[model samples]
Target: MSTLPTGYRTVVVPPERIEELRTVDQLAFAVAPDPEADQLLPFPVPHDRLMAVESPDGTYAAVHGSYDLVMPVPGGQVACAGLTWVGVRPDERRRGLLRAMITTHLERSLERGEPVSALFAAEAPIYGRFGYGSAADQVRLTVPRGAALRPVAGSERLTVRLERVDPGRHAELVEDLYVRAGAGRPGWVPRATPALRAYTVGDPPGRRAGCEPLLLATVLDGQDVRGVALFARKASWGEDGADAVVKVREASALDPASTHRLWSFLLDLDLTTTVETPPLAVDDPLLHLLVDPRPTRRRLTDNLWVRLLDVPTALAARRYAGPADVVLEVTDVLLPANAGRWRLVVDADGAADLSRTDVDADVALDVRELGALYLGGRSAAAMGSAGLARGDRAALDRLTTAFASSLAPVCPFMF
Candidate 1:
């Protein structure tokens, strides 16, 4: 366990101390606090899961929290501690506060029976040293309005409804469709609590930043909700006239027809010249449906950074893609129990069995790379080429084939 400096201690952040936590967070992130916005956007962290470093003067020097998340994995889901809201006051840098806080987080998460932890990194370079790996990537697109899509047979038959978002009425609907739409895809994390669900649909005027109130677009087939999109438009006028932009906050569709119908409505919004999408999986259906993708501007980014708190449990939680018998020599710096040889044997049924072993390792990698390969989105051979992993050519090929996923893993929204 990491130790705090003299005169500093870690403390559990209670309800009354939330303001202090927020103050430290705002200072660290360089964002001004809006009380009204806070009232609308529910506090997402549970009190018991919130923690902070207290200075000698009783002020919070740093703060962090986690969400009890059921993170989807290949063929299953695992109890994941979604690490979030991490911040350290600028004046407190290099004091080992962040390291101490992370140690506490890992220990507490493991104590609570969460074998895995995931986060969307504020900065990409900070987490790998702590054993978190860049596990998945998401893509965003800025497409011209009226962009064409190849038609699906039933897309024209489904109808769309657009209205101002109502958290009371639409939160459940949005959550339901989100869960169903991402049924088999790895890294699809749903809003698991009432507060999280409320935050998803919440809109405060102060947070709108000149855009219209958030809106919901639903695609329905005979009163059955087939898809949903949460979006907002910012009006603009230029020499060309009425060149507005549509920004989609989150979108999910259960079927190809629903996806086609939803995008058809979003792309043709009156006065909007372009539409922006939220983060999407690399293999998202919308990408394949676009008739001409060349004209769209695309940005790819790292999505989820995964860490294994309990190596054996985490590896066993997800099913393998193919038959395999291999031993991995994994090194974990933060958690010493994970630093050893682990033999993983997968049968034809894709069920994996992992046990401690002293046999020769077929592959050697750090726990960070293991986390990267955990979701089946990354290739062991590719990491080997990058020198992040080591193995012979055949062993790397066997590991890659056993871990490949047909669909790219992505968590569409940041925690």
Candidate 2:
């Protein structure tokens, strides 16, 4: 490692160097306090796919990433990038290496046409300084075998395929599914690279192998991929036998019959006792369809942890549909100085007071929470009960829930 920032180099991880990248993530993120990145890179580092900011001078810190995204807009499309692994050695902190690394990567991402970037933050307060916020919610669930779903007598035309999509072609299908589903919700990523797609479909041995994700597709009439169910066939997620579940990977579809068939199909697996799904939209019809809400395990968690790589753009890109006059206390560990309070007020339909202000803040939260609430992790009502929000709990609850997504967060893959 070089003594100074000079002579530093950036390279995509090579096929052989992938293991080294994993070692760095294991070492650096291990001590700094976030495991999200660590969990994301549990497999081999896709060096050919991995982007890194390394110190040729032998500086000990480096950052790694897996894929890029394309953000869809009303008029056009922009690139949305995904940053998987990020870490800087303790000795390297305060030297601005993380920020510099993100800046270099994001700038290049933009150059590559990526308009947005997303990550699952290990620490809630680390990304705000860069402008990322809680853009989505994630969940963990458990179900019972007694409540196992059985198809209602006779249903046809739905086929479940456990086969794999070739690496060369899975990308198109995964991206297709994500984009179609994402348009209906907030805090969703639209791109699905090969690694991410396989991770979603392939469940290896161990807890994940037991997952047994069933790649489902519903066809009405000829051959329309109207709906899909990315759910594991396994009984549950935890070790305790108290739970039985079919972990939902990810789904994309619009047909009502398709949705009905998908859920009902998973509910009726043999030998399984229960089902626990991760953060589900409070408004999802699936919730209402359940005969007993008590049997369903529901908990709020941040879906997509946001870390603002670029402040102004990150804040501006998202469309806020909440009540006006809500300032926030944004916090970040990577950029501690950005850890302060700010106001978020709306004028007309767009946002105002995005810049720093001395006004009274309405909602005070960390970036991770923002990511949680952004997607569906922390409900305004839940936050109110927790005392994070002073606004009308019922109103925020109703509104956010209405916006709450029916889609589940399923990233079984981390390439």
Candidate 3:
């Protein structure tokens, strides 16, 4: 067994005893694959996994994460330990383990030079207790069989190239080009990894079990990689086998020219018969480029999870779209200091009210959900439906939609 780190509880433990720290989690939330599970088989990121909350009787109560995230914040580069798998053991319910983990995580995040810490919340009403708010929205899109796309006639001379290169090689190629495409996007992590690279060009479209993805990429210049799209083709149970759907894994272009050319190329594939791209940003240009929007179906989901480690800093950091006034009543079952009524007033002069207040606000919600909602992943009305928000239904809807813009939140890189 390995000895605990400084300031950590003394317990007979192996390095893999990390999961036991999540005992509180086993008691509180759904059981699933652990996020801290050894960084997806290939390239492991720099991280710190540890137990934070412990019972007076010496039982480990909860786990908290502290990563090297945001050490380079101004450079937009930072190692982060977005708190995850947080819960209390079943026998230890109603205690303050969640609070302890959150407080500790935030302190460590800042201490480690991480200006920000993020997480997708498991419950809508939970994280506000920690002073977080919804930050983004994600769109789930489906392209029908024979669904076609064409640029406004006589667009630039169109061309496309598709091939299966060595996974290790192609992924590196894609990552090398990814940074150029990620500008001006929110909640996006630079997704470049050997595992992802291998998955990019590994299994073929045959039936050996791993033929899962159908990757289509193109280099507009006919040399340097510019645009790439990953998808899986499967036949639906219908009279026509021609009816198939291609679920896109990720798509990006170095520039508008590449964007238009790449999507147009994929949508026009005669062999695919059909294509589907899951949740997209409302601001995504592909929707506008499409000949028609009615044919495309949008499914909403909660992605880009946010857990605010620092209230003042996180609130002041994000760029807002329109000028509006909203006072939100925040609720948090996890963190008590964040549980209170507050005014979130955004004005026409581009000023925002993140300060405390004694008056009622226009809307209400948990801090975490608000962070996700802030990004437009969950609409104010939708939050209301989930019982996380309430206020002027019409006004709230207008403000939330306008704030969301057309861009749908998406983080393809899991970590």
Candidate 4:
């Protein structure tokens, strides 16, 4: 456990003190409040999860919150604490306030039966020391308008409808399509609460950075909506001609044809010279359908950082890709309970049994590497090669195969 600074204490922020909490966040992040945005998109952090570090004089020195998230893993989902809204007052830096809050987060999450925690790191370097691992990578693409996609079987039959987004009418539909599109993919966390759902569709004028109001485009097959894209266009004029840029906030499809059709419409919008996408799964259908990807300006960024608070429970929650029988010596600094050797046995169906054992270890790794491999997106062999994991060569190869994911893990949106 991390020790708090002298004369500092932790406390749960009360509902009446939300403004005070917001003030701390605003000061920490250096952002001015937009009352219109807050009124349109309610804050998603639950009061029960809002915690702060109070200085000796009772002023908030730092704040953090977590979401009761059900995160998808290989072949299943597990209870997860989605860590978010972490901020420390500028004057409180290097005082161990962040470390103290993390200790509290892990303990409270485990008490709530969550064995795993995930976050979108504001800075990539901040969380690894706390046992969080970068488990997934997301891609953003900037494709020139009129770029062609390889044809899909039924793409021509799908019809497209584009209109201004009406959150009141489209929020539920967008959320439903999001759930279906991300089915069977690891780390796909749905908007489980009304506040989160509202946040997804909310487009207050203050939030638009000189772009048009949000737009909704749906790919339909008869009466069935097979795909949807939420986007906005920022108009521009150049010496040659119109150079508007279409920025897609979210895009998902139920089928290959829908995927092809959705991007086709998005990439060929009139008056738009470029179309940019939000972060997408590494194996997203759009990538496979693009005729040539070399020209698309791609940016790959770390998506989800994962921490296994209860190693045994977290390991058992996800299925393996293949049968495996091996002993692993895992080390965890923050959570000593997980630092030990364990035997993991997997059946043909990928179901795993994890228990403490006194057997000789076939592999040795830190809890961070284990968390990285938890979603099956990262390779054991790579970690072993980097010296982050130590294991027999054959064992490393086998572990890589068993832990590989058929679909690349992705968290479509930041928490």
**What is the per-residue lDDT of model 1 for residues 256-313, given as tens digits with 9 covering 90 to 100?**
9999999999999999999999999999988998999999999999999999999999
**Cα lDDT tens digits for candidate 3, 133-228:** 656556666655445555444337546777644565566666656555765566666544454455444444332133344565664665656677
For all candidates, the clash counts are 0, 51, 45, 0
Q: Model 4 shows how many backbone clashes?
A: 0
Ranking 2 against 3 by lDDT, winner: 3
TM-score of 3: 0.65
- C-alpha displacement of 52 in model 2, angstroms? 4.4
Q: List runs of model 4 lying over 4 Å from the truth.
A: none
Instruction: Determine which window of 10 residues in candidate 3 has minimal summed lDDT.
Output: 67-76
Cα displacement (Å) at residue 370, model 3: 6.3
Error of 1 at 141 (Å): 0.3
lDDT rank order: 1, 4, 3, 2
Shift in Å, residue 92, candidate 2: 6.8
- Cα distance off (Å), candidate 1, residue 213: 0.2
Per-model TM-score on C-alpha atoms: 0.99, 0.62, 0.65, 0.99
Candidate 4 collision pairs: none
Give the runs in model 2 whose Cα sits over 4 Å from its true position: 1-16, 28-60, 72-78, 88-116, 128-131, 146-175, 203-222, 235-245, 307-415
